[model samples]
Target: MDGILVGNRLIDAGEYELAIDAFTRAALDQGLSADVLAGMGSANLGLGRVHTAERLLRDALEKDETSPEIWNNLGVALLEKGEIAEAEQVLKRAYALDNGQSDSIRDNLRLVLAKTENSVYDEPQEQDYKLIRRGSSDYMIRTISD
Candidate 1:
């Protein structure tokens, strides 16, 4: 798991080369853990190697089709590659796998759907904390009632 952890950090740092190396090392050492393959797919996706990500994630799914996160990330990669229908299908599967995993998948789905939306909402309904633009400050300032 060390390599996977390290690869995650590398991915966050935008170091796709290093992330890919770490994920490949982990997968090589572990020999086809679906988890490892998922990591590889994530790493490849970060590098904009969407085709590789798709293939690796597909292979991982073959071994274990129950991982919500894998399906979610695969959808993101597919979305990035402009494979809209495939991405939507994968994201639906991710949502079906687990509700907790649905947020990110739904966010991606929303982004894609936004492209087809007739119009954007004028603004979010007022709440306790509304984003504001003042002369010199921008903050999530909230109102307190006594």
Candidate 2:
């Protein structure tokens, strides 16, 4: 099987390390194509390496600007790293590229908008947090109120 397919499967299985290795092999074979970079980025994101994922996803975007999936993945990475404004913009692009057809992209966009709107709220003493994954690269953030 192709390394990109293998890497994506590994990511869906939540084997992030194996996915990274698969993506690395794919990158070596394909010379860092957008799909390979996106796969690597997704693996890193799954492993909680947000900064690395962001860089790889950005690279992927440079290689293929029209891919909504890449844009969505980058948005997720940015959101995880607390770059809310940029994430909102990235997700908006993804949503537009997809013509609002993808539920995952729509959900991510809504999550970013909610975060942007809620940023003005008074600080709570403490809040619970949740990381929700919709797909290999799609992430949704939720705050649990005490």
Choose the strongest candidate by TM-score: 2
- Cα RMSD (Å) per model? 10.9, 2.4
Residue 2 in candidate 2 has what lDDT? Answer: 94
lDDT of 2 by residue, 7-119 (tens): 88888888989999998998788898999888888888888898999999999889999998889989888887778899999999999999998888898899889878888
Q: Which ranges of candidate 2 are over 4 A from the true structure?
A: 124-137, 140-146
Poorest 10 consecutive residues by lDDT, candidate 2: 122-131
**Which runs of model 1 end up more than 4 angstroms from their true locations?**
100-102, 115-146
Clashes of each: 0, 0
lDDT by residue (tens digit), candidate 1, 52-146: 98898898888889887777777776766656577678777877786744445556556545532423444422223221111111111112230
Q: For each candidate, what TM-score against the reference?
A: 0.71, 0.88
Clashes of 2: 0
Number of the top lDDT candidate:
2
